[model samples]
Target chain A: MKLFQKMGAALPSAKKLVSGLLDESQPPVEEDQGGFGPPGGVLWTTPLDVLSDRPKAGLPTQSAINAPLPEPAPALPPDSPDRSEALERTGLLCTDIEATSEIGGFIGACLVDSGSGLVLAETGDGRIDMEAAAALNTQIVRAEHEVIEVLDLDDHIEDILITMGKQLHFIRPLEKSPGVFLYVALDKKQANLGMARMQVGRIESTLKM
Target chain B: MSTDIAATTEIAGFIGACLVDSESGLMLASEGGGKIDMEAAAALNTQVVKANLQAIETLGLNDGIEDVLITMGKQLHMIRPLEKAPGVFLYVALDKKQANLGMARMQVKKIEGGLSL
Candidate 1:
């Protein structure tokens, strides 16, 4: 239908077409009826209050909601010159992937502790001031965490994205590891989000820390 | 350089979509990154998304954005953070020659409207 309009062709009754589309597109909702009543057919089956708050579906068990995570990560060594090694040396995780194979001359990488809003470890650069990244990222993680709680579902967060003129920023939560995140900064000109996600997925498969 | 995401989605045809989550690096939900292994993608892309999210937040806008676009010689990247959704985002990429970024966001917005959570 949109194509017909583009081809210098006369559209066939745009009003009728749109009205038909609306009927198919608009799902019946309690919020839409006269004064917030249940959908057309819902009232006959269940109480209006019970039908309105229906969850999306397949909710996980309560035990899974607050399931105890594997022990919290170890404290970061304040002065360890080698950040990645320091994180690993804490004897908390078995982060054994060699940086060379994982990143391959990548510009920079870091693990920001989402809880404390601090940089736990960074690789490929000595002067990035990742601490700043941590502090800034903390507020974001906190805000979203609140929203997620409001939604009342505990499926761990996956990732966040920030796009710009010349850079592509990606935030991925270590869902298997809470309050710990993997931050990847990309040259907007160089990285492809599709390809980047694929490569990063491979790297994390073996990257425990 | 079309600003319409719906047209872009129709023309470029990305497999996945990307959204921002009021943050620089949060690649919320993307189209074609594949089920390559959610854990790895989440971990690595997390950094990329975070880096960008912070940069925007630090600018002192004191406000968030609807979406951001990156156009390369060969590709187009799309990011839309649900201003109301907060942490969730939508990420998308399309071929430059084929995409009309102008409509990509529109398509994404339509998708978001139907989103449950």
Candidate 2:
């Protein structure tokens, strides 16, 4: 009996539910507004649409977009010898001396201060003592100066060459920098003195100070 | 004995040349110096030779000097100690523009060989 009574009450609720769905499917029609419907006719709005209505102060202007971008720093060539960091401390570049190591029979090379006998920069094959050579060669420079004074040879020392039984030593004072010299030791058998001197002169010209 | 250094005139771009005694810095024979004072050069070059010798000895190179060459801005100077004579040396100067260093060295070496003193 109780089950029959509950069935009777549930049937009316089911009928009411069907009528609600039918009403939703037959919604009242309105005049077509073409594809360009009313502005607020959208069911839901996107974040872009919401923000688009606001001020554009933070956005880039048309002129800003058309302007050229800043250029990247210019790159150095692969074989360029100017090493800026190493060159900063002293005007004498080690890369310049390293270029001298490319000579045919280069035993060693150094840049020396003729006044104080200091080895500013050097590169070598360990066959020669650059420090002692720098100091001794300073004396040679000084002696040459004395000779110049005694002879009244109104000139400066360009270079001094020492030819030994098996070796050749070259000392060239930088024309731009006073009291600074480039010293190179080479094997006599493998080096051409003329070419070596020419190359050394070329390298000396590139030195700034 | 002094050599006939007059033979050195044949060298190309020859400016001046002399044979100097390394001890007293005196020229024994000389040839072809227009504006250059050969006497002063010979006397001054002797010190260069001595200093080179001292440098060689101090470095303990255990070898004798073959030659000492000074390359000046306008000139090339060569100081070669004679093999036959212990205390005598040959000094020659050349104009850098016209002189060939290798040829000059060879000619100078040959002249040094013919020198008796």
Candidate 3:
């Protein structure tokens, strides 16, 4: 049976009272030949009182009226970390390589560990064996270090530029991290060496450990 | 003395010079002498040239390398791949105190131009 029908069956007197309140045109209680009353002859002063005080016949009587309303869902903390920001921080290295590759006449680019010559990341066509290149460049950097010590010139390496008949190579060791460096190749005819060098400097500034 | 020797002798601070085949990393001809090892320098510089070529190829850029300059505390190293000779390059080292970059570059260009191979 429907809940409302069951409720009506349990509270016949209250149901009649509610109906009377809904229709004012109905005969007054005193004039009506059959006025509504409880089955045991109890009287109700008002319908609201019965609704508030009485429990339904078949429903459980476990302080339903005093049950606390469900608490509103808890809100997120104000200082919660942003997911995108974390991702951007983690992906910063790859983004640096991509930005470098976008320069005009870009051939290949790599981030290498200067001490070990291990390639951390590389972006280039397969034509250039980056592994061999990184290893070889490490030797060149070491040779430069040896020359510096032997000559006692006190100056440091800023960058190395190798211009060829067909290409240009730029190598710059990271200032912040002395053990890592960036290398890039470019086409001679298409790349502006000055602009390319400037772009590399900018990228170096943003590279994180 | 060969042409390579004669050419290198004219430079004021000419420490050493070598013509290296970039593909093989082998020294074709060499002249002069200094603390810098000509054979080792030529081989290492050839790798530099090859690496540059690989980088350009990987970048898919339709261009060429004109020359490369390395400045050190006491010396300057220059590498220039020949235009007529695709796989060969000239590697030259100069004493910074005695070498004039403008003059050295002009002399190297002239020597490269005069070379038969």
Candidate 1 chain A lowest-lDDT run of ten: A4-13
TM-score of every candidate's chain A: 0.50, 0.56, 0.55
Clashes of 1: 63
Task: Report model 3's interface C-alpha RMSD after superposition on the true interface residues.
Answer: 5.1
Superposed model 2: Cα runs more than 4 Å off: A1-96
DockQ each: 0.04, 0.36, 0.17
**Candidate whose DockQ is highest:** 2
After aligning candidate 1 to the native by TM-score, how far in Å is the CA of A153 from where it should be?
Answer: 3.7
Candidate 3 structure quality by residue, lDDT tens digits, A1-209: 23233333444554454344334475323322132543212233223332545455666345543444323223334333432233243343333577877888887888888888888778876555777767767766766665455544466666778665667777888777757878887777899877987898888777765
CA shift of A85, model 1, Å: 6.9
Return the top candidate by TM-score: 2
What TM value does model 3 have? Answer: 0.50
Candidates sorted by lDDT, best first: 2, 3, 1
Tens digit per residue, CA lDDT, model 2, A108-154:
99999887998988999877788888888888788778766775656
Clashes of each: 63, 0, 12
- Give candidate 1 regions above 4 Å deviation: A1-92, A95-106, A125-128, B1-54, B57-106, B109-117
Q: What is the i-RMS of every prediction?
A: 11.0, 1.9, 5.1
Candidate 3 overall Cα lDDT vs. reference?
0.66
